[model samples]
Target: MSADLGWWGVPLAILAGTLRGSAPFLFVSLGECLTEKSGKINLGLEGSLLMGAMSAYAISYLTGSPWTGVIVAGIAGMALGGIHGWLAQQPRVNDVAVGIAMIIFGSGLAFFLGKPFIQPVAPQLPSIAFGSWSSSPQLESALRVSPLFILGVLIAPLMQWFFRSTRWGLLVRAVGDSPDAARAMGISIFKVRLLSIMVGSALAGVGGAFLSLYYPGSWTERISSGQGLMAVALVIFARWNPMQCLYASLLFGGAQAIGPALQSVGVDAYYYLFNASPYILTLLIMIITCSPKRTLTGVPGALGQTQE
Candidate 1:
């Protein structure tokens, strides 16, 4: 039930908005963080996310299980990353160009596969109920968030530890910063990048699945138009640290929720502009966080490399 939340209920609304908005980015940023950590940027994440959305929705509808759909979507995204890695390992096509091509292919593929399932309702994820603690109806509704949101929150710190403390994490950083150096030290740049992309793509796919099987339900040609793109930017803003990605993603998520929250409270004069707030905030965060000075600390050194 929607809360009778009045003007003072802004905090509750923001809380609700943060959960709703952040789930998608949580998935995408986590994925991009891995890819960038390996010193490669997979702009094709857009395609991967869209493809995952379609694949997840179709599978969920067919199988009557959202979790199963999520798994299949992740596999599809990894396959896409595998193709990107193989092509990138070749000299003929640039990674950027391949990524762009992948975007087109992914979008088209999502559209094509998604056509038949557009109207079919698929199995959706159940929300976590933390409402028992609250006595007020408004409070209960406010707490109706999902377990996946909590899952995303937990992944962030785990990623930070993996990056800062693990042997593989050091290897990933070493490869990103100096492939030649890493090569001399017995690390494989190609393998690292390939694995990173696959992991990132898989997360992106899961993120897409969240959109269709949880937040909105069902699917469409443009269900994930720019969410994937913004998430890549979020990874940069978070500086390749998974813990930071969590906070940054939630903030972006809050910005998106603001537009709707305002509209819901009978404020619509600037609703259209509110719709664009999230993207604008994303741009601003990237511009501020990606300055050369900040990037040195947060950005991967191995990004956009040319093998010699």
Candidate 2:
């Protein structure tokens, strides 16, 4: 692919990388989006992502079924999220503080438990070859897409619809926009927030599964590279909109692909620097979107607010 297209390979590789790399971002951002929409923030998804990766890899190795690994990973993430949710509900407790603790605890637990599975091989999730019709190997390789990625794509619109049209969605929105109003209407704020956090964390775990079972296809301590944390910034960038999260995730993925895409075309002079594009892009987005003078357009009103 690189030799055939020369400089053109950069864009093609980036497009391919966008499809491959964006899955994790997409899942994490969507998960975070759901959590934020229900009036909570979960910083522990970073830990969840790592735990999911480790658990998925270990489970796949043991069970010889990648799907089972994915399920276990989601369960692992849900456990961590459940802990955060329960602790946050305690009197005088801060959800953000609980989230931070979860990050430490989850990461440490994953690191401790994942040690033995580090060297084991696991079955990978299969891909659908979108480019099978093409004779060129590079094109075919570039177009080989993951089922999880496809699922993420479908989920974006579904989530958008869910938030717009469903009764449960309205309840979530009401809880996020004004907890007092939701409470006045007899909604159980604790249950809604807990469920949102758990569901979101499960999605984050699935994202982690994608990391181990698909792209890079291996278990590593640093596989996530802070993508879980970045999902928070991405949610803000997307204004808590599920469909917009998909676009923002793809942009991040493309940025991440720049370095390798360039390297594939023999442009390695600033490879490491290019690899930092996603982080740099994240920093820039945060700066631009989080300015005090610039009101965030679609932020949930109850976001970051402590439950009384």
Candidate 3:
């Protein structure tokens, strides 16, 4: 039932790829946004992602349930976040340096532990057949959607609302903007930041789980491909706005799909070039969004600074 739509299929393929590709970006960006909102930067999320992927894949292989793997992966990410948070709180410690160290630790740990899982198969996440109404088998198959993608879309608006309407959200913003003011107001800066980092790390882990358990659906050493780092740039580009993160994710997702879309259209030349599109696009986004003349509009105050 494999029918080709000729050159017309490229757009469809890209569209499908976008849906699949955007989920991880959306999740990771959202996680980083949360962490930055609390005035902390976690560069170690790249490691958290790898750890999450390996944990999820391994757990699923053992437990016979992908959801369990997802939950465990989140916990693993939280542990990493907790470690980073604790280390950052130590006297004279540098948050960025600790984060870099954590990244190495996380990656090394995952690599060592994940070795056993590389060859095993895990249960695949279930997808909704959104293309049920379509007669074209290719279109139908292309439209098969993961529930996680839908969840990410739903979470964006909620995050926006949470920041605008909730007391805790205001507290996080206050802490990020001015620690002195937050302390004067009787808010606990340490608690807020610690919790934020842990929650953000958990979200990143869930994103990792989505990568291994759902989309590409496997465990591997190179599974992340720097998606976590790309997310840092994405948060900056989005100006730390949750809603904007959704849009940015889609843009990145489309960029990632370009290579495969070209292949679908029989443009096999320079396949490596097409595959490099995502990284190249990341570079372009960073260059366009960052500037020397003006202060960034939405950067959290005290970001990357050691908290007292």
Relative to the true structure, candidate 1 reaches a TM of 0.92
Off by over 4 Å in 2: 1-3, 279-294
Model 3 bad stretches (over 4 Å): 269-273, 279-294
Q: How close is candidate 3 to the true structure, as a TM-score?
A: 0.94
| lDDT by residue for model 1 (144-233), tens | 787767888888888889888999998988888888899999887789889988988998888888888887666988788688888888
Number of backbone collisions per candidate: 2, 0, 0
Q: How much is 270 displaced in model 3, in angstroms? A: 4.6
Tell how far residue 179 is off in model 3, in angstroms. Answer: 0.5
Query: CA lDDT, every prediction?
Result: 0.82, 0.89, 0.88
Per-residue C-alpha lDDT of model 3 across residues 1-308, encoded as one tens digit per residue: 76769887877877788788888888888988999999889888888888999999999999999999989999999999999888887777888898899889999999999999999899978999999999998788779889988998998999899888999999999989898999999998889999999988888888889999988889889998888888877898899999999998988887787888788788999999988887787678778877898888888897877854
lDDT of 1 at 160: 88
Lowest lDDT sum, 10 consecutive residues, model 2, at: 1-10
The whole-model C-alpha lDDT of candidate 2 against the native structure comes to: 0.89
Estimated TM-score for each candidate: 0.92, 0.94, 0.94
Q: Which ranges of candidate 1 are over 4 A from the true structure?
A: 1-3, 280-295
